[model samples]
Target: MKSEYLRITGGTPLEGTVRAAGAKNAITKLLV
Candidate 1:
């Protein structure tokens, strides 16, 4: 299956707490 990727350009320093929730059976892989 094809997968989507993400790219980030110039941006101010990020601050504050970040949180994420993932699926129990999710597949994770690194592209490039």
Candidate 2:
């Protein structure tokens, strides 16, 4: 089987002391 990939073309701007929290998984879980 062949795997397929999707592409997203865009730009994200983080301004004014933006930050990513410590755990990504925790963030994803929290988001859900």
Candidate 3:
């Protein structure tokens, strides 16, 4: 299977309170 990736963009400093939901069954790696 072909690999799929995500593109994210933002310009603000992340502050306080982060909520992550779903995406536990993915076979891709996330690089931050």
TM-scores for all candidates: the values are 0.27, 0.32, 0.24
What TM-score does structure 2 among the candidates reach?
A: 0.32
Q: By descending lDDT, how would the candidates be arranged? A: 3, 2, 1
Off by over 4 Å in 3: 12-32
Per-residue CA lDDT of model 1 for 1-32, tens digit only, reads: 95543343466664563232452123222211
lDDT by residue for model 3 (1-32), tens: 96544554588664564333555334223425
Global lDDT of model 3: 0.46
Compared to the true structure, candidate 3 yields what TM-score?
Answer: 0.24
Flag regions of model 2 displaced more than 4 Å: 1-21
RMSD of each: 9.3, 8.1, 8.3
RMSD of 2: 8.1
Q: Scored by Cα lDDT, where does model 2 land?
A: 0.44
Candidate 1, residue 7: Cα displacement in angstroms equals: 6.2
Candidate 3: pairs in clash: none
**C-alpha local distance difference test of each model:** 0.38, 0.44, 0.46
| Residue range with the least summed lDDT across 10 consecutive positions in model 2 | 13-22
| Distance from true location, Cα of 29 in model 3, Å | 19
